[model samples]
Target: MMFHYYAVLAIAALSCSSTRFGVVNAQIVGQFSLEFTAVFKPAGIAQKLFTELSDPETSILQGSILSTSGLIYDPNNVAIKEVAGQFAGGVQPFLNPPDISADGTIDGQCTATSVNEEEGKILAHSCFFNICAIEADDCINFYSGSPFVYAPALDQNQLPPSYPGTIIGGTGVFEGIEGSVEVITVAGREFTSQTSSSGDIAQRIFLNTNFEFLERRKI
Candidate 1:
């Protein structure tokens, strides 16, 4: 059988600087919703790491992981807007587990690109994320930077949950551009995982995101 989970999550805003544009100069907010499901499929110790239990039934450990999602999409409209990506990096407190407390965190980098095969234009970016579990059911995440950073400063460029993230740089038309997005609405569920016949038990993460483009302009 297949397992699925849906959670309502709150999203953080992002920022980027530009002499030609300002957040206040934003004249319109374009809203878009994004949803996607991901899985953890690993070999050797990884499969055991994400699927095993610690002494307290739930514990987090210090290790690194690499995971990828299937396909993400924009719903309702007949036309499809999609993207696919993955995350990989280190986790805190290996002796203890993956998601246990507010201190349990994941520091990683991600790469996502829009897949609008029909239009022949694929927009993709490379960025970093810092996610910290707040409680048993909540976690705060920060994402920042882009592919153009020359070097990836995963730790230094992180954007916090309370603040909007800025666009440092990007691919294609987003190059040298600065902008911040507003959270229209965000909601998700408790993190859950399930085992499969293939020995790969992936956690189910269902997220619904609606955000408005607060600022988008060339520098």
Candidate 2:
């Protein structure tokens, strides 16, 4: 009975020590960025017929699978400088010793929400990306919540080159994380025509994604 009483006291002491040291309710505070080139390819396309009074053109929904074997680079790296050069209309030189930091794929789907005479079609997209971190030897899944694409005259070229996107949540090291992503289309092609029922096209974009861990809830 005496030994049992001592053990109970010891456990209580350890608990108090942990509380005093601020071991509980620790906040994760910091941010990191990821950059990679992903190629977008059509995976599926479905047309939605207009049943109500609306535009004469048929609305279509499209799904795409974006894959990448491209090397990831730190924003401060020389390889990124080269990409920036290309963005600025300078010759894009090959990145030697290509810094292989990470690679990933994204699954995305978009549908027309509305059509305008001069502004063309407005699309809403939801995309999720899974990345393999070669340096950390881990993986993170980032969900880009709804981002809008405004295409004027039904031309994807009218879409914004750089747009704001959000990382609502993630997995792995990024579990319970949230932040913003700046999507920059370094190079892209027009999406398949709305009238065409079948075909595929390829395009590339550089995703500059940033993250910060969300405040952890107390147990």
Candidate 3:
């Protein structure tokens, strides 16, 4: 069965000077959106880890990991635009020319901390995305709070629900940046085995007038 997920996340940033938590008043807000396909296919436990529970009723226990890597795209293209139309929210495809990529790569990592079998959801911790520009060496990083709900797919053709995240900081051109981000899982698949899982995802990044960006060095 092929699982799919559709996300329309918004990410925005404000340039800052301090590390972790310092705010500078700059009137300029950097905003943009990028689309990407995410795949979760880990080769082994070293890259992906799962904790098995004795409860046979439990499909997913606490302390499982979600890791994936894929390509980033500029949503302005016709191919992605057509795909966006198939989702629920009649979301328009767009591209922010200055900071992000026309096409690039993305890597994500998140770990489950709590499980809700009754609701079919898991609370994940330290979720983040590292997106890089194609051909360029610069990459921007976005992170989630200590915990966020990881919703499961509704059917055999969809992925878990998308969640909110923050732009902690970045490297090279994206250094000392701050912003708000909404990650849309445009497409994805559940990792159901000891070997691998796969999916496709898209992200829309925009700046928030009320908040400031957090700074952290690239990993």
Candidate 4:
């Protein structure tokens, strides 16, 4: 009975101490930047047909998957290579009548490795002129877990020809760390025909990015 009483008291004390420690440790915040380039090479393509509306309505949907490979360069001169598989689908909605403007949304995901073999998924609500973003931008977030766990609060966008992106938060080794990036893109839509390679109707983009990182003072 005496031993049982002491054990119960000891366990309660430890639990209270742990709770207090957690409360004392505050989360950190910061911002930084990085840079690199990602090349998305189309591997296959597919067109989604709307049977009910056989006659041209006001939009068309097309999608494809690409083997993405790239290297990310940081402001501190760190090189991070990424080999990823990305799949995306988008619909080119027509204007009031039937004007095909490059205003649409593309949503997809990519699996790559940097700090670890993490498959980061993203849904970018963006606009583009053919394969290039013209005077528009997008915001995307990424989460990585496996060897290490982290989240790159993403902002992938383009201001006309080039743009900037940033990371707002993270976890584990990347906890309290934030980063930023600059982007310059070269798309196949400008270089190659709209449809090519055995009528696959492919599209590719070379995304060049630069980054920098900073750790917060707390946590």
Candidate 5:
């Protein structure tokens, strides 16, 4: 028998920043669903099995189940094209923001630029930071010192768990003009198990299904 499963993550942009140091709000919405069908065999065994397995009464007994154990991150945010442009005399400014928001909240900001002229065209500064609350009066801040490849088409699923993947690839200040960029693909998989029984006989099974990241543009 074969089964099909699907998982989706929906993101909604709450607002856009007004300036280079402005903040934005967002949400992380996720869902999971599964469909099961029995593979047919010769001599009507498959038809009989499917008929028996698909019955309202037996469907529950044979159907595969799916659940949301937990989410990787409740909410994450990444800033793209917020601060990018050429400086005076076409001196191309090194584009780097103060921080990147993973929880959809902006805490702090950073400023960065290219080290040289030629490097400015091929590379840009990629800085990111996050805010952590300490009690009600105190809070700790974190930041990324070295810049990374700046690619807006990518998303967190494409980068390391600690940072969003949307920041990977393209010409950036992190690496110099001569620096090289590499493209990579990342995917998520869901784990599932199934159990069935007929009369006194019973069986247990386990399976793995894959989920893909769909790119969405913020309007």
Candidate 6:
């Protein structure tokens, strides 16, 4: 099967929970400034549809859904704790290095697993683990596992000049792409600034959104 890779446009902030697959509320948080293109299954009449959708004048709406299958990782490990905290909650106040997993890779006995498909061209997967750590205040907190993208790939022409070749797997699905095509925008505040006392923030998140079209053959 020919898979057309799309770029990872934005990171959506999901609600905190102990469940495996995080929930994606229908809200845009941040904007995606990157630029690129993705082409999937370009054949015969499909080519015309692709051209129309890819056109600059055309407007594309991006959305996503959570995967069913989840992965496994070390929840008790420090690295796992940090990632769990970051994925579940943003950087903690007055906590430098705040146990945030800056790097998107799995850590501490984490493994990726694929879930059974529910519909056509739709697959479910996730990465799960836990974290237990002691704080400076002599307090102990335990964090459960969280889900993230497992298979991220870049489609042809989706990467920009600076980012050449396709990058498969990362925070976002497509490594390259341009212009807020699909993005997660914070609703009430900016990513760098805090607007609420509870530290309630927002992000424009995309989940399992894909596009495919056929290309016309020149005879």
Most lDDT-accurate candidate = 3
lDDT of candidate 3 at residue 168, scale 0 to 100: 78
Question: Best by TM-score, which number?
Answer: 3
The parts of candidate 2 lying over 4 Å away from their true place are 1-29, 42-57, 60-102, 114-119, 123-149, 152-161, 190-219
lDDT tens string, model 5, 29-140? 3432212111111121110111243554442211111111110111112111212222111111111332422111213222333322233221233333222211121111
- In model 4, how large is the Cα lDDT of residue 28? 35
Instruction: Estimate, for each residue in 1-219, the C-alpha lDDT of model 6 and write its tens digit.
Output: 011122344565332211122111112223322211111111100101111345765421112222111111112111211121221132211212345221111111222233222211212222221111111111111112323332212221111111112112222212121221222212111122121122222222122323211221111
Model 2, 113-211: lDDT tens per residue?
A: 443424544455555554443333234455554546655344444423454566655545555655565665544333345443222222233332343
**Clash statistics: count for each candidate:** 24, 0, 20, 13, 13, 38
Each candidate: RMSD = 19.9, 14.6, 10.4, 21.8, 26.7, 23.5
**Each model's TM-score, in the order given?**
0.24, 0.44, 0.54, 0.28, 0.20, 0.16
Q: What is the descending lDDT order?
A: 3, 2, 1, 4, 5, 6
**What C-alpha lDDT values do all the predictions have?**
0.25, 0.36, 0.46, 0.24, 0.21, 0.20
The TM-score between candidate 2 and the true structure equals 0.44
Worst 10 residues of 6 by lDDT: 39-48
- Can you write out model 1's per-residue Cα lDDT over 1-219, one digit (the tens) per residue? 011112223463333221222111212223322222222223311212222255555322222132332211112111211222111111111111233111222233334333223332223333343222212222224343332221112231221121234433332222233334222112111112322212222121222222232433331
How far out, in Å, is residue 164 in model 4?
A: 4.2
lDDT of the structure predicted as candidate 2: 0.36
Output the lDDT of residue 161, model 3: 56
Among all windows of 10 consecutive residues in model 4, the one with the lowest summed lDDT is: 15-24
Candidate 3, residues 29-76: lDDT per residue as tens digits? 334332233322234112444444575544554666766676544343
Q: Tens-digit lDDT track for model 4 on 50-69?
A: 22256565322222122222
